[model samples]
Target: MKTALPKLEPGYHQRYIIPMMRIGKNGNKLKVFKIRTMYPFSEYLQEYVVGMNGYNTKGKPNNDFRLTPLGRFIRKYWIDELPQVYNLLRGELALVGVRPLSEARFKELPIDIRERRIHYKPGCIPPYVALLMPDSKGNIEAERIYLSEKEKYPHWTDIKYFFKAIFNVLSGKILSS
Candidate 1:
């Protein structure tokens, strides 16, 4: 048996400052910072891959080949997301809420859900951490529940979900996908 080599050279530095964007509150478009975790040009293939592979409940595609080995580890521990702290500092994101979606993903959602999601800023810790859903549909449902509760409880809803998401991360009950 022969082992395969990586298609591209290892890119530790390239991973540090990749620029991406996400849908923000009121449908504002925001540039989000992240460590690059996928193969070069992976973003261009997102739709094709998602169509074929389908997203897990967490909204990650199953058996994604775009991820490099280091990327996988980075994603598992969410090291890839560290740069998004800048987005938080910029007030484009909350400590707890739904994960931000790309324009393509956002457009794929139902109109009503899209309207509801855009009502609040996206979050660093998503509702999925609290609900632990089994599929993308379940993740959507979790977000719906969080959004509804947020409408009723506002600060308390975020505070409660924030703590729950933290506990889940610390205990390794949920991980970035």
Candidate 2:
């Protein structure tokens, strides 16, 4: 993402710490890195994602406008996440699993739902049916449908897409986002 986002938005530039990270698989705070999508030292960093301040705090969509020409592109196609390959190389994530969420969101999750993710590692994509959330109308409902079939999450529902998505990434089939 650091190498690419600039081509999309010229003025955008930023760095990030993604603070108060949650622990790792071995029970230590995890802090993987990625390229920035906001302006340099953005003021928004001080602002939380969902404002719960306890769990899931890391998932905030701050509505920042610091995107550079390239930054926009990276985010559009989620290319900014490429650097996480280093994390995977180091075993910070799995090829397929539940998406890591803000601490606030994680803490806020219902016990059953939260525990559902405990069996797997965080990863590049979520097991979610993202298409439903595209219109911004069905995140909860989609989650409900997914929850009813909890045994099929990130594994059954996600593995196929994960492979397909990886292939698309390798093949350059989905870009310019």
TM-score (all chains, Cα) for each model: 0.88, 0.56
lDDT of 2 by residue, 25-129 (tens): 433456555666556744334334324232221133434444567777777777677776777788887765555554544666566656655555666554343
CA deviation > 4 Å runs, candidate 1: 1-15
Model 2 lDDT-worst window of ten: 129-138
Quote the positional error of residue 11 for candidate 1 in Å: 13
For model 1 the local lDDT of residue 129 reads 87
lDDT of each: 0.83, 0.51
lDDT string, candidate 1, 101-165, tens digits: 89988888878789899989999888988877637787778888999999999999999998888
Q: Give the poorly placed runs of model 2, Cα more than 4 Å off.
A: 1-28, 41-62, 66-69, 129-158, 163-177
Native RMSD of candidate 1 (Å): 6.5
Error of 1 at 14 (Å): 4.2
List the lowest-lDDT window of 10 residues for candidate 1.
5-14
